[model samples]
Target: MPSHRAASLLLALSPCLIAQTPASPAPLDGIWLGTLHTGGPSLRIQIHLHQDAAGKWTCSLDSLDQNGVGIPCTLSSATNPIAIDIPAVHAKWSGSLTANTLDGTFTQGADMPLTLERQSTMTKPTPPATPDAALPPADATTIRAILDKDLAAALSSGALAPSTNAGVTIGVLAHGKRTIFTYGTAKPDSVFEIGSISKTFTGLLLAQMVEQKSVQLNEPVRDLLPPGTVAKPASGSEITLLDLSDQHSGLPRMPDNFAPADTTNPYADYDSKLLYADIAHHGVSIAPGAPFGYSNLGVGLLGSALANRANLPYNDLLHQQITGPLNMTDTSVVLSPSMRSRLIQGHDAAHNSARPWDLDALAGAGGIRSTAADMLTYLEAQLHPNQLPATAASTPQGKTLPAAILASHTIHADVPPGMHIALNWFRADATGNFWHNGATGGYSSFALFNPDKDFAFIVLFNTTISDKSFADRLGQHIAQRLAGDPAVSLAN
Candidate 1:
């Protein structure tokens, strides 16, 4: 789950247009408004098109409901059927343009109908206020009570249906104290897929390697690939480890060659063989180190490259480097028998049973699974890296775990609007808070912490609801409460 506010601008335009074309295409300049039928709530979408004196067109998008505004988008064409691409979210839209309306479908993972009517004048809404910087840390008891009440209501109302084994587990760390709360069937030790949060672990591994001088941030990723394997974009430079971690590697969100045998377990059969073949056959079109584009392929390739350099499997390297030293026994891509017993069944948005993802070659992207207890431990290390026990290994250059942790959290790139990227973690410019969210077919998780306030929050849910922002909103609201800020409703 990327920031709902940041990730909701999923509009893209394809080249396919309606057969009929206007004899003289109308100017696309000015504001256009529409409603996106996303299967649940209708989202109001606004698009701004500008034509420069040079006759070039530029575009931006706004998802009003999600508070995503001024999202830069690529204007693919200015012909009869207008085309636009939002590479950041791997989405596109292709519509036939008319005098006052643009009719098209928004395509990301699915196609949804959208119609934009030209607006003569439009006004922008004020953005939400940032969390105050000077508020005191929130009280744990109050936070727990609010969360308990909200979770109970959600379950009782069938909002979290197929609830037989469904529940949520929350962990908070404030002022050096730790607290764990469970609602419904979730327990402190219940196992759930942490999804993209695994990227943070992979990022830490990259930092460790960099700290040890095993690799340079600017080193070309191809250098570490197996012999005879080639990974290069059609133009520009080769992708680097830093570029991959920061999501600037220009790789698409996913490989076009990916055709899963089992839609239920999409990544299960996608092994290294297919991954390599795709890279060689269909190299990236954009240059490396380009503007931010979320690329699971890029990070997955990075994990494979690093493993090749170390002469170890990705999971083995992960354990030896991060989880093993941290003693996060419950965290790993390959679960042990003990972990399997505690693994909760995942559910789709509709509350139907969903299979867990395997993520074979792409384990670096979103594969690891763990319990709330383990995640809190991981977060604790991040908060107070210097306090980690002496048992944790240090880099060969004598760089300690604390140094690597700080390196991973160092801001490296911008993620539009006001968000910044620190390795796989997202940093809020206003609050200096670091956070990341993860979602798989059946689960969603959120982690947020502010070092200045010495506070952290982690939320894990057993199902993926229609509203993707549920977990993230819950975590942020708790953080706000802990900071002594005004209490906000946790209703979805």
Candidate 2:
């Protein structure tokens, strides 16, 4: 849907300082390290300062407590009573610089007193560097070599060579053992855009919200929109949240107002204003639930409606509802510096470097970036939905893991004799397999698992293969190899 863009991480901040700092005289010009003693846990704080050749001063904040690094900010008044503005997170810090320490207050929604003392050394840990080479870990399974040969065949076919010069990571989960393989310039932790797999997450979010009774799946779309907003079809039939999740809402693949600043990285500039404007001016292309027509706009609107109902951003709702409980820490709409560092560069099928897509308003359609390791963990949770916490300790976003998982995977529409569509998932009723595939401008990913066979596989490639069917076939092959059932394999 769009290209991937690197993002700065937003660290969670609490307003309290209960720790003492060791005093130093190292000229706040290097790195200042301190601990923010808040009511909860201690947070590691790092402040950096530098002077360019022009003698212009610059500084940044790193809150290790929240895993944020290099938060951009503007400095005010270099002398006494220094002001540091971090508008990205709506935070600001003001303190007076002394010979070796600075004492001031940090304000982010609230104010907390803080003291920073220069560190003895500038050895703060940087984000992990890219892997030196692409090699599977020593414990790789036989599938690595097999998958390599398969990939080589795809490359030889001239299908992948036209627009791909990227890496791939594959995993085969068979008999309770996971064997991971890497090709090109990828590592186990390398991240790729999962594209429409994000819709599966949105589907899960819908299930969680419905289970919590915060949202009614069968309610009218007009009821969820802001008061007086128009979102109606020509048939006069009401669209429901279920319609959106089921891909029967009759919405287009994308909003008509989508005029991207960069076509290569399209969704980056589309915001809520544009999304709403498009919705307000648009009419349904078809009657609701008349047929199975896949619509990214429908799912994106579903996610937006859920966020509106919960009074939270799509990303936050996602964290509280699904990712947090499943411990899919690396899956997120926003990339932390560490996650960004681990991201693999995507390539077109032509083997040219491509820009990454960034989402502004429609993250639910395709805005998630994740790693093979994290995705497998998610698949594991899906396999054992009961393992999800009955209820989130901090939020009312759990307790329906079983029902949600079941509801999401249940067939809602039949695509054909072999394929059936569920809540953002395609189920192979013939083979008892549940899966989904995703692609973006520069990446293609396949995630599939058969619970009955106790098998699953995730294959992520940082190249625009332009053939999701090819990727799906690769995934089916892995699933069959693991399940020892060639009968389940799809014809190539």
Candidate No. with top lDDT: 1
The C-alpha TM-scores of every prediction are 0.82, 0.66
Instruction: Report the error of model 1 at residue 79, Å.
Output: 10
Best candidate according to TM-score: 1
Model 2 CA deviation exceeding 4 Å by range: 1-142, 148-164, 231-235, 284-289, 389-395, 467-470, 485-492
Expressed as tens digits, the lDDT of each residue in 307-362 for candidate 2 is: 88888898988888888876678999999899999989986544567777888688
Clashes of each: 6, 14
Each prediction's Cα lDDT score?
0.73, 0.66
